[model samples]
Target: MISRLPGLSLPERVWNTARRWAVAWWRILYLGAVVLVLVLSPSSYGKGTRRALARHLYLDTAPVLLGFTVLAALISLVLTRIVVVTALSYGLSRYALEMVIRVLVLELIPLTAALFVAMRCTIPNGAQLSRLRQAGRFDALRSQGSDPVRIELLPRVIAGVFACVTLAALSCVVALVLAYLGVYGFNMAGLSGYTRMFGQVFSPSVTMVFVLKTLFFSLAVALIPMAAGLYDSGERAQPDSELGGLARMFAVLLLIETASLMGNYY
Candidate 1:
């Protein structure tokens, strides 16, 4: 049941689609910038605001942190064991630690943490925001001389970002520990070699990319769904409305990961 405009050529239609996507991305970036600025402004944090931010941060981060770390530790243990055993069998054990650090800690953990936060916090919050928007809650707040973005949206943004970053960082630590233990068993003798290897693997540029990539993932997870919700026209405020935003967030995550890989290896 889909149809195109009667007079538009294929190239024109394609250009129009691209233009729409570009505008959507611009809006997301602009809104994210506004939120970032608000976060930095001292006035945004009164006693109630701070309390609310803290509550939201706890709700978003604490419950998930332990579970995520446990899961990540288990996965890292398995991967590390496999890599170590395979490398030992092939007489290439020296490369196993580097591979684990690169693959698990540097790449997989961050990406998985971002997705986990998106699913656990941001996407649902975005859907709620969309529902509020559809129900005219934001409009009502504005009419009463309240800035809904600051009072309502900002806390969620902070919570989402914190959750993503905290989960990634904690999971990364777990992965690194599991890797070391898997490779060297429960012994302190390998500590010096392990430190040297870790140092070599995380050179300045690679470390910068890893940090930046995790930050970018956090920001995207916090912002994209909110942008989609804030700008939603009420017509599509069904259960599936958040799906498009989720897809967009995933795409952005993949793009960030790909760029990080290029920076690290290429």
Candidate 2:
């Protein structure tokens, strides 16, 4: 309607889009919170469910993601060398480590991990859940006195969170080591400077933000796919591809990263 007005409609259209986006994300966060609560409950993890889920989630998936760690480290090494060499040439070596940590550890690693989980785990999982629901498995499970959300969705969400956290942490550790190696050349002379630079960069507030951002990343990784999968859980609905869920999740991931960047820098 407003597009007909061109100039006048531009502002109105932007306002409408922003309002709709805010509402959509708020609803997503509310649903995510509800799912998290269910997963956090003691009952969600049956007698051996938590243990079994952990083994499957951590042990089984960790090695597969180690490849990502190696790749991340190699990339980090390149970036570290570039930053160090450039900074040294420009007499900005003092700022090199801080830049490396901020870019790699605080920002890049977490986003990469979250995206990897989103693609490798959650999106497919959501599609599978959608198909299962379409097949009446959910109804059968519920009718048999089984909790589908707890038994099925909870594991995937928890596992997604675990996977994101593990990947991000491992990548950050690798990047940190590479940064040190690149800047110090296997020597101890820069250790004091490194510690001081890191401490200065990661003040209490900055550290809190980093933690909160990582938590949000993990939550987004877990919640989006499950939320998307459950988008049409009602039996009365026609079967629909969970592609919408994956798309929405990717959109949310980008938004989360953008917000994190703005929060940290602006």
Candidate 3:
């Protein structure tokens, strides 16, 4: 009597366990997404899908890029003025441009842009996916002969990837210009060293890999949260689920970034 009160049967337990694993599998798929991007890099250069991806990326990233540019410009202006004042105080104004480019454009801006999009876009997308799942929309779509994986999920995935890459590129460019002005005061004397450093940091292979990494990061950021969103089945689809989705998304994003950094440096 005690044992039969309402305990889950073996199959029920197995099903529950499988469901947990399915949720975990998305984390794995996030890694797989990165690998897929790397493998598909050659084809993405000029293919129709890649072109569509680029268009979506540009469209989605336009507002964000503009905002980043404004913020970066303001910060650069303040920092440049500060550096110039300090240099005048010490007769060392010549090094300001190099410092700005190296510290801000080459390193900080790209990373900051990626993080901003991750927080602003990817998190909400995940929440929407969760809400859709809770409303049985995904199932309803499936019933109506729609492939959720292809139609609903893939576009966002593509868009996310595109946003990250384009924003990174745009931010990097802005940072470079700001750095040059801050340091060299519109002169070309430092162009050779700047180009040399640019080449060193962005060798062909490195650029290719960086693009691939951003693509993967975007895909994972889009997919994992959405996948986590699907975990709210039946009556469990409450506001709390949104928090869970965000937590899962953050964890997955960190995991992907860590893996990417390790792959690159190690």
Candidate 4:
């Protein structure tokens, strides 16, 4: 029962691909609405649900993020030393602190945190959720009058967003401190000039954009994988959907980084 119309087959394939992307985007939008509701509804932060999620997010993820924090600190310290030495070598030592704050704090930490949550938590958890669906646990939950998206998936999504925001903020603070130490050592002699430079770099407009960028990064980290899981419209679970989700997420992340660069530099 196969009809091989070659010319029509080509057009059909093209339309199919287009339709697939369309469906994927629609699913993403729907998930965005769900997340918005969760954000606006105070019930989301109720005692039992948020406690379990936050406890899991904080306690369980703390060890991983602690290790990650040390790693990021080391990397930031190395990069700070390099930027400082290079600036001093070029007689641009005065600009080094500004560079450190802009590059490491505003740019690197947020993107790195998003990627860490994506790779470590989101994708793997999504794949596992897919497996659960494939194993008929989805129906099992439904049989108990439990909606998986609201009860189960939302927590993971919220947790991922929380993880991204938490890690990014914490890492940026650590990097800022390390940058100061790298450029000025333990003494506070250079503190006044450093504070002036920080003020110049983090003006109100720049701060607003930074907050917006971080918010977008958090949404992207949280939404993509879970939405990908929702949109796995195949007969069984597969990696193809997860891989496509990652590609899409990173594309958005890159765009965010590029926009931040333009905002900061241009």
Off by over 4 Å in 2: 1-27, 233-241
**Relative to the true structure, how large is the alpha-carbon lDDT of every model?**
0.86, 0.76, 0.62, 0.79
> How do the residues 89-198 of candidate 4 rate in per-residue lDDT, one tens digit apiece?
99998888888788888888888888888888877767767777778887887999766666667777877887888888888888888888887899999899888888
Whose TM-score is greatest here? 1
Question: Candidate 4, which ten residues in sequence have the lowest lDDT sum?
Answer: 231-240
Per-residue error for 260 in candidate 1, Å, reads: 0.7
Model 3, residue 112: distance off in Å is: 1.8
Alpha-carbon shift of residue 40 in model 3 (angstroms): 7.6
Model 2 lDDT-worst window of ten: 232-241
Mind sharing the TM-score for model 4?
Answer: 0.89
**Every model: Cα RMSD to truth:** 2.8, 5.2, 7.1, 3.6
Stretches of candidate 3 exceeding 4 Å from the true structure? 1-22, 25-59, 78-99, 201-209, 233-240, 252-266
Candidate 2, residue 241: how far the Cα is off, in Å: 4.3
Backbone clash numbers for all candidates listed: 0, 0, 1, 0
Which of the predicted structures, 2 or 3, would earn the higher lDDT when compared with the native? Answer: 2
Instruction: Name the weakest run of 10 consecutive residues (lDDT summed) in model 3.
Output: 232-241
